[model samples]
Target: MLSYSRVILSLFAAVLLAASCSDPTGAIIPDDHSLGWGLALADAVRDSEFPAGVLFMVSCIDVNDEGDPETAIPWQFYYAEVSDSTNVLIVMVQYIGTTNHIWEDSTSIPLGALPDYADAGPWVTAARDSLGSAYSDWEEYALVVKGNEYPEFPVVLNVAVLQFMSPDTTEQLSVILDSDNDNVLGIIQY
Candidate 1:
């Protein structure tokens, strides 16, 4: 027979053990799909006094066919732009298991604010058009290929050239984030 003190101690140990078994990384939490980055971006654009805007997102779910994230890695990239060339925003979200956290950062900068870079306009345009038509919603462009040179996605052979047309002027620009083979692509207009 166990003494009362020993039984109490055992219960305390069991509680501690259960707490230790809880998820440390919080990745298992389902995406609530609440009002997050997209809505915030629209508000930001409005505050900046911009006319219309467009939001582009590319995500690579690092899950195997079994839908187990533990078996793979995850990557997400986002881009938002106003009708004018004045403001462009970017966000990147990555999962780092070693730290047991999801890492993310965002910034908004003007198009000409960055230094000069190579013009892959033609390549990107051809690639985007090759998909037939640009849909206003996110769509999967490719599937994850295991043991390939570009495991995250395929090499981006085509680039997307987005054009924001307003009554006054038409702003055309190429966003640099690209996913080759295994990336999901989609655009949201506001």
Candidate 2:
């Protein structure tokens, strides 16, 4: 049977997968909303990650902005064509919309101290789903950190990270990396 934490992660992931997309040009981290019209794209890339012609789209969703220390959530999306010739995966980080994360947290919880669960859900889905596939194939995977707890709160901002892949011999990537809250990095392919 699945543990409560696992179930929460699963449900959160599923819910996020369904409604995960932001403007990618909103507020900055909580308490730092003054950062201005865009969020920084945190990314890492390597050669042979995927084939050429791979397209990537990214978006971020705001979780809360009710009051002070507004927390902006990250919801990224990637779309691309899958092909045998594709052999390079480039991780491009893009800014998305702004969100208010305060709606989910209480007065005692610090915005920055918020658990990884808040930032992890959308990030994992975005990073893993960058290929526009609902899931990943054997050749690659996007390492994502699964959460154990699904906090009960409201979302103020919702972002979508869209990506495009180059299609060749492989089928169209149509899924994101689904995990079981193991905290293991999800793999990705080109």
Candidate 3:
């Protein structure tokens, strides 16, 4: 079980991510969606904030798919999109300053913030809901592979963990792509 304080943070993150993933039309969560960084955090444990770090948003579109600019996840990473365009907003937040847990693969900064990352683009949220609510409620983040940089490096058939990291914990939303075909996965935090 999680402590009272931990639960509150987790819930807040869940709601934030949920809102981020969705748009004016709605967000989609697949059963086999790739379990990204944030998704796992909400899935396995409860943290007031995630371990500060950087998460990569990767995506590709299916030409004949449904919805405006509908697409499928590539075999590499996933991203949160407010619209069809590549424009996405990765909300950078840090609730605490120090943490014992650090991403093993990445070097940790000595100071500044708990979770930190950057985007190659600017962020723009709904200023005001001219069409009802100025909020997009996305339930899950989408994992899509754009490309495999090393094509000639002996491509081995393996399961690639294309996902977004919370810089804290790997928790919910969903996992659409999987090792096996014909299925997608989704998760929720309460």
Candidate 4:
């Protein structure tokens, strides 16, 4: 038989464990384009203890094929902390249904390779508008901001839109924009 104090302690521990494992899913709004969603994502990243440094990429995954542009979906933000001249600690924040998951990996990357942090909402909207009728068919979108090798520009925003035709077929559209001014640099389909 356990003492009353021991039983109470056990109950408290069990409750804490359950609470930690439970999903906190009620906070995120269902609209990704809203400023609230962006702030919430930023808060999640800060709460997750990941480096809030420059963002390397931001991706919205599994977006609905319907024409609802405001619908929220899973999003991923990637950041890097350069530990040395040739190695970097990559931190990824994945936000899904108001829950944030943090993942870390170490890889080799050039020093001072940090990408500029930009508000991707405007750029995403611009790319969607450029798609015209095809925007409704896109299932995913991603924004990559990084320094480019091209001497003409220091950094560029590469937006990729993906559409799924079937289980085995997928098409991609790449919209390259000038990061400084959000001007369309090029568009390619693949």
TM-score, each model? 0.25, 0.19, 0.17, 0.50
Estimate the Cα RMSD of every predicted model relative to the unseen true structure: 16.1, 23.1, 19.6, 7.1
RMSD of 2: 23.1
Candidate number that wins on lDDT, 3 or 4 = 4
Candidate lDDT values, in order: 0.33, 0.29, 0.27, 0.49
lDDT score, residue 55, model 4?
48
Model 4 scores a TM of: 0.50
Q: Can you write out model 4's per-residue Cα lDDT over 1-190, one digit (the tens) per residue? A: 4698899999999987876766465333333443235435654564456443444444454433331223444455445554432222233333333545454555332323333333555566666667788766654554444444344444543333333232334767676666556676666777
Please rank every candidate by lDDT, starting with the best: 4, 1, 2, 3
Q: What is the lDDT of residue 23 in candidate 2?
A: 27
Regions of candidate 3 where Cα sits further than 4 Å from its true position: 1-58, 61-141, 145-172, 188-190
Per-residue lDDT for 148 in model 2? 17
lDDT of 1 by residue, 76-190 (tens): 3233353344443433222332211121243332211111122222323433454344422223222121112223435443322232223333422222233333232433233
Q: Considering summed lDDT, which 10 consecutive residues are worst modelled in model 2? A: 102-111
Using TM-score, give the best candidate's number: 4
Better of 2 and 4 by TM-score: 4
Q: Give the TM-score of candidate 1.
A: 0.25
